[model samples]
Target: MKSHRNLVVAATAAALAAGLLVGTAGTGNASSDRVDSAPSSIKTVSSGWSIPWGLSWLPDGSALITERDSFKVFKLTQSGTKTQVGTVPNVVTTSGEGGLLGIAVSPNWNTDHYVYLMHTASEGNRIARMTFDGSSLSGYTTLVSGIKKNKYHNGGRLKFGPDGYLYATAGDAQTSDLAQDKNALNGKILRMTTDGKPAPGNPFGTLVYSYGHRNPQGLTWDSAGRLWEAELGNSTYDELNLIEPGKNYGWPTCEGSCSTSGMTNPKRQWSTGEASPSGVTYADGALYMAALKGERLWRIPVDGTSAGTPKAYYVSEYGRQRTVETVPGKNTLWLSTTNADNNGGEPDGADKVFQVELK
Candidate 1:
């Protein structure tokens, strides 16, 4: 088995060196607009997490993390000690990808104490809000529901935008036709208030901010206040999209790039094998994306709305990365591994959180 693994690595390295593995290495162009180096070091912050799926930092410098299958949430201190915060109510795991997912603390957490969560319920995927008193969670309220959920493709990423509104990503749930439906919440990025109503400036006066997404798991904003997403493709090309209100992203009609009218093309794309891009966070001038099947972190330099060529780092070194978040007011990033889950198939104690120093 060791010999076979070595041979596979050697073959993959040869393919990468020969330019056969697309987007697996840095594009050799030396320019100021592109990422020229990878992260300098990766230090494990914590271990023994069971498929840590969500990470959100609190004002007190602590982080709240969620376990996908266990439906439990933990409060992790900056020094790496984890204490069980509590389990989310009514979360159910269907396939491996479902169950407790993305989490975000409210921007006014000091006053309201609200924390948002996206999870798989028995009926479908839903978003809920809870109150946290810095130790325990309570006051659960279901904000949104009826998002289609299948055994696969249940998109569950939650975030609070810079505009102080909640933003969510919903998958097509394997129903390709729903991606094109503007009225449906599936396969769309939704912008809403804390009460789950549509935001005031939402396109179409509905919660649907943008439509035609396959399974977007990442959402972040650049320093310029432009929204960006990393979406998983259907067997062809994954995308890094510049999201605009009321614009169509061309998921079912076009996988990567097309000339279709009323469709927006991705700023950058990668073959599906090289980039099942998941969580994304923007820091400095680059958008860092966490890859699952690609098993790496991609640094895509962003200038205004355009993205330069991507550079890969930690390829196959940390197993499957599920989330990447920029530490607030710091040059470090917090990353979570999903190797203990069914997809990665690594041994027990395989899941971990790492603090990476950006170069």
Candidate 2:
């Protein structure tokens, strides 16, 4: 993003300490100012870049943002300054939905000095660990691997739960029938330890936390710790599902919802044209979803487990939204547009990141 290409040089120590302090990306300074509201205004924080896919905050309030094709990560400050922290190794693009995907800073970062990344590798999609000493990245080690990969359907979003376990999304990898195979890792939500082993209390005693997914690209937890997933459908619909451990979500059996007895229906479903959704976040008692093909942002209010009607914002104003993240400690959001590659057909370096003001 052009706004991200900094003119003012930054100190290494101060720049590296930008984000992280547990419980979320925001800090205590603005903790009391926290409000849950829908985005009312938007500002361009960074401009003119490739597909900026993943975003994570550092402990000191600065954030780390990733580009899909470049396989690079930039550290962005709240005031609009950015610095290149370092590039990840062993990342390969599928020329479709692969490359550097999701990133998460350890909740125990102060003592661990660890950061995690999910990316497309030579063999398949893998989750890897690297040491980020507050400045640069080093020491790459594969924590989880052997996930089947395809040009599309490579679900790659990562987050840490309140229970201190890592959770990830794995798509069906174009093998739709395999989504029903609990013996496989593809098409499931995986819960694991930092070392890549299956977390304790997982369903089926495997990494699979929940199964029967197609191309689930988005995940977020609500106030009650309920996991919400956004999945891309085959032809008819996309889904917003409230995930439960060991529950069967009908994939090949049904696209949106069906009368299948053992299948769990979604909380909400959208037409594929309206929502090729990705990167969901909880804000203001609602879920702010980034729509890729819909080219808009969706604000769906939530009361307990009930999802209210969704209101569309900035419809067609920003083209092809990819990621929307809460700017910790505030009732605002940071959204990115991916108008550069894949179906967008725009020039390679024509993307942007925005700061959305919430009510």
Candidate 3:
């Protein structure tokens, strides 16, 4: 089994170098212009980079962006100055979507100064924590390992929930059955302590928070503390689900809306051709979703318990939007591009990090 997995990873890396595939990567400013009402007012803050991925704010008023292909993390200042922080640990870069992926800061960052990451480690994709000692990384620990691995479906989104616990999304690794297995860690939203242990009051005794997810690339919380996830469907019916503790998302069994007796239904579903939702962020009392295949930014208005209709901007505008993150203390969002994926468009510089102003 180890040998087979190694061969698969090797092939994936080779394909990546050959430019046969691209990975997820985006961000920008918060604007007063209603993005849904005036789509044309969406402005770019910055751009020009190799593929970029997850994003997070730093203590020095800067931001960190992940470049999956190069296995590097960049610190970007307010003026758009970019500096290489350091390469993430134990990432075996591969094609069609595998590399150093999601990144997040400790919720209590002032005391811990730890940065958490979800990457494709040797034993498979895993979640780990590392403390940033101002200049470099130290005190590394593997919080969780032994996740399923494959070319695609390696879900790696991470965020700190309002409840002071860490929430992460994991793909099924192309093994559809794993999504429904309560004991398995794949295809689920996992909640853990800052030390990587399962938090108390978890629906399951283990790390499983919610199950039956297809490929959840994004997770965010509304002002009401409601959890929302952006998931990628197999061939159709992408979803925005109201995530509940221990609830099933009806993955391989159900695509768009929920029909299963025990699973939760999606609040909104879009065709694959419209939105391959990746990163999700809530700012100014709204949720912003970054699209890859749909090549647009979706501004979905949210009330306490319900979400309004999705208002899309930039349909085929920037090519392939990957991640959307809110830069705190500012009214802007950072958006990235993924034009190197198996389905991404050609052109050497198509992969870039961009800033979009929100209204």
Quick one: best lDDT, which candidate? 1
Model 3 worst lDDT run, 10 consecutive residues? 21-30
**lDDT to native, each model:** 0.86, 0.82, 0.78
TM-scores, all candidates, are 0.93, 0.89, 0.86
Q: In what order do the candidates fall by TM-score, top score first?
A: 1, 2, 3
- Go through the candidates in order and give the C-alpha RMSD of each one to the true structure: 2.8, 10.1, 9.6
After best superposition, candidate 2 residue 275: deviation in angstroms? 0.5
TM-score of 3: 0.86
Name every residue pair that clashes in candidate 1: none
Model 2 C-alpha RMSD to native: 10.1
Candidate 1, residues 49-125, lDDT tens digits: the string is: 77898888899888999988888889998799999888999999886578999999999999999999999999999
Q: State how far residue 238 of model 1 sits from its true place (Å).
A: 0.7
> For candidate 3, what is the total of clashing residue pairs?
24
Q: Mind giving the per-residue lDDT tens digits that candidate 2 earns over 77-145?
A: 889887777899999999799999999889888899888999999999999999888888889999999
Off by over 4 Å in 3: 1-40, 347-349
